[model samples]
Target: MSLIVRVAARGDGITADGRHAASAAPGDTLTDTGEVIPGPHHQPPPCRHFPECGGCQLQHLDDDSYAAFVADRIATALAAQGIEADLRPTALSPPRTRRRATLHAEGGLIGFTEQASHRIVDMRECHVLHPALFVLVGPLRALVQRLRPKGRVELHLTLADQGVDLLVKATLPPGLAAAEAITAFAQAHALARLSIDEGYGPEARWEPQPVTVTLGGTPVALPSAAFLQATAEGEAALVAAVREATAGAATVADLFAGLGTFALALPAKVYAAEGARDAHLALKAASAQRPLFTEHRDLFRRPLTVAELDRFDAIVLDPPRAGAREQIAKIEAAKTPRLAYVSCNPSSFARDAKALCEGGWRLDWVQPVGQFRWSTHVELAARFSR
Candidate 1:
C-alpha cells in the first residue's frame, strides 16, 4: 500500500516550489505539485515535467542558481577531500538547444517514459530540443501514431550540420508494414532524414545518413553516434573555457579526448588519448595539426602510469562519470607539473581533485560550465598546478 504525504510548506534543504525529501507517511499519497519553479542562480524550467522526470532534476532551478549549485557541488566534493580552490560559474546555454535525444516510444506512439515509471508520457512540446525539432514534432507524432508497433520504441534524433537524423526502434507485430508507411510518412512530411530499427521487421536496416552542425559558423561534422554537447551555446562556452585553461601551455595531453574537441583549438601540442575507435577516427579527421601522437587505450581499464606522465608537461583529462581514479593515482605518483581536469560528474571529480591536492598539486580554479541545461548535470573544468 502507498502512503500520501503532504508537504509541510518549505523548510531546510527544501524549495518554495514544494520540492522535498521523500519520507514515509501513514496513508496519504504524495501530491505532485506541477513542475518545480527554479530558485535563484538556477536554470529555468524548460519542460513542463520539471523535477518529476528522471531526465532533468535541476529544471526548476533558474540559470544563475543552477550554475551556483554546480560550482558549489564541486566545491563541496573537493572540500570533503581537503582540496580548496576558487570555483567560477561558467555560462549557461539558451533553452531548447538539444541537438540529439533518444526518446522512448511504445505502442506505436512516440513519448518519453514517466518519472521513475516504465509507463510512457505522450510529450507534446519538448522545450529542450532544437527549434527544427519543434517544427517536426506534429508530423513525427502523426507518423508514429500511424505505425503502432506492439511494444516499446526508441526514437533517436540528431541535428547535424546539414539536416536532422531520425532513428526509430521498435518491435513489430507479425504483419505490420512499417517501412513503407514510415517512408511515405517521412516523404510526405518532408522529414530531413528518417531511419528505422525494427529489431524484427522486414525493413530492419533503415538508417539515416549523418550530417554536420555548424557551431558559431564553424562547420563541425560528427558521426551520429559520436558524443556531442547537449547545447550549442554551452559547447561554445566550454570550448572557450578549455582554451582559457590550456592557454600558453607548450605541451599538453588530452586524456579521453573525444573527437579532439579541445585538442583542435589548443595552442599546445596535444597528445590525444581516446578509447573509442570511432572517436579516434573522428579526431583524426577533425584535427588539423596532427597531435604528437594519438593512442587507442582505455584509460579506465589500463590507466596511464607515472612513467607516462613524465612525457607531458601538462595534462587535461575528461573522463566519463566513473571518474579517473587510476589515472589520477598515476599522475600523482608521477608528480606531473600541471593538470587540468574536465569532468561531468561532480562527486567523482571531487574525489579525484582531493587526491591531486594531497599529492601537492594546488587547485587553481574550478570553472563550472552549464553544458546540459535544465538538468542536474554539470560540466566542470578544474585547473591544478604543481
Candidate 2:
C-alpha cells in the first residue's frame, strides 16, 4: 500500500511512492490495483454523482484537507515563479453556497457535464448550488423535456436581489407554443428575469421588473451573462482582503471592475473601468452622487498607461482568468504606491506577481479563496507595496 501525500491540480492525489490515484485524498492509502482506501483526510462525498460530475472534483476530501489543497495550489504556482509571500489560511465557502452556475441540459437530463466528457450527469441532488438555484433544476429538466430542445440547451442561473435570473440558450428559436410554455415556467417559478438566446442575442420573454445584484451594499443592474463571484461568503472574503490591501487610500482605480464590485465597496473616490457596455452603463446609472466613477475601457487591448496608473493612490485589479498581462506590465512600470490584486488563476497571478516583485514592488501577502468549493479552481487576493 502507498500513502497519498498531497493532491494535484487536476484533483488526483499523489502517493508517496510516485503513484497517482483518482478520487484519493491526502492521508488516504492506495492499493496495488489502484483501489483507494479512505484515510483520515477522506470524507464520504455528499453528492451521489461523486467522481462523475464535473461541477466538483475534490468532494472526497474533508474540509481541512480541502483548505490545505487550496493553499497548496497557490503556493505551488507561486513557487514555480520563484515568488513568495505570506500565504494566509484559505477561506472556504460552505456547501449550497454557489449563487451562480451554468448547467447543461440535453434530452431529459439537466446537470453539469461528466468529468472530461460530453455526457451529462443528470443531477438529482446537488450540494454546491444555492438552494434558490438548485430548486429550479428539476423544473428545468421537465421544461426542457417538454420543449424537446433539438440537441443541447444551456441554463445559466443567478440568484439576484429580486429572485432567480435565468438565461436559456437553445439550438433553435423557440416557436410560439414553446415560447408560451417557457413563459409559463418563468411565471410559475417567479423568476426575476427570463431571457432566451436562440442563435441570436438574448431576448427577454418575461421580465416584470429589472434584475439587480447587490454588491457591497449597492444594487447594480444584473446583465444577462454578467460575471459574479461564485459565492457571497467568498465575495465577502475577497472584498475584505482587497479593503485591507488598499486601506486608507483616498483615490483608487478599479481595473476590470464588473458592475463596481470593489469600486462601490471602497469608501474613497473610485475610477471603475470595465469593458462590457451593459456593465459600464449599469454602473454609471448606479453611481449617481457616489464618489465612484465609471469608464468603458477594455484593459486587454488598451491598458492604462503608466502615467494614468500613477494618478491613483492605490489600484484594485480583478482581471479575467487569463490574467492582466498587458495591464500588469504597465502597473509594474508605474509609480503606484500600493495595489490589491484579486486573481482567479494562480499561475497567471504568480506570473504577474513575479513581474511586480522584479520591478521593485514588495509582495506583501496573499489570501487564498476557495469559492469553487471541493474543486481544484482556486482564487486569491494579494497585496503589493513599494
**Global lDDT scores for all candidate models:** 0.66, 0.93
**lDDT score, residue 377, model 1?**
71
Model 1: worst 10 consecutive residues (lDDT sum): 3-12
lDDT of 2 by residue, 18-46 (tens): 89989999999899898999999899999
- lDDT of model 1, residue 20: 54
- Residues 206-294, model 1: lDDT tens digits: 33443555433334456544577777776676767677766778888889887666776677787889998877776665564455467
The prediction achieving the highest lDDT against the true structure is: 2
**What is the overall TM-score of model 2 with all chains considered together?**
0.98
| Ten residues in sequence with the least summed lDDT for candidate 2 | 171-180
